[model samples]
Target: MSRTVFCRKYQKEMEGLDFPPMPGAKGQDIFENVSRQAWEEWQNQQTMLINEKHLSLMDPNNRKYLQAQMERFFNNEPFDKAEGYVPPEK
Candidate 1:
């Protein structure tokens, strides 16, 4: 059976990640508090942000910006999105 966490983002108990999605204190915090579903949502958003903004992880500033956004995302705060992006409608 999978572990459950009180997801900070969804604000409810849900399935937790098998392991921390990353390293360090932030990753451990996320592993203990963020649900897998929320993490996946951030992954999608992160990918979009990277592509639209041409973010390079090699750049410290870019990585820092993404890290901040990730924190905001898990904390259920307003986070930046790719400007001018429109979801495809079916």
Candidate 2:
């Protein structure tokens, strides 16, 4: 066997070994559980924000303004000539 392997096999007898703790010495999934929960919460908040923005963009008054703008352009009116259409509830 290689000298390094032989020496490590009896490393406890050397009296100067400084090996780190074996895996799971403190607890398993300590950092992993915390990180996973944080990531899931972040994803939920992002999804909620995205859904709110989508709903606002799809609102009726916003759609009306878009339609009016398109109509004005199709009728050959200058874009600036269309009346400023404010959102109904805003």
Off by over 4 Å in 1: none
Q: Distance from true position, residue 30, model 2, in Å?
A: 60
lDDT of 2 by residue, 1-76 (tens): 2111112222222222123212563222222222333324334434443454443546787546544543343344
Measured by TM-score, the strongest candidate is 1
Instruction: Name the top lDDT candidate.
Output: 1
TM-score of 2: 0.26
Off by over 4 Å in 2: 1-56, 80-90
lDDT tens string, model 1, 7-48?
999999999999998899888999999999999999999999
- Taking all chains together, each candidate's TM-score versus the true structure is 0.93, 0.26
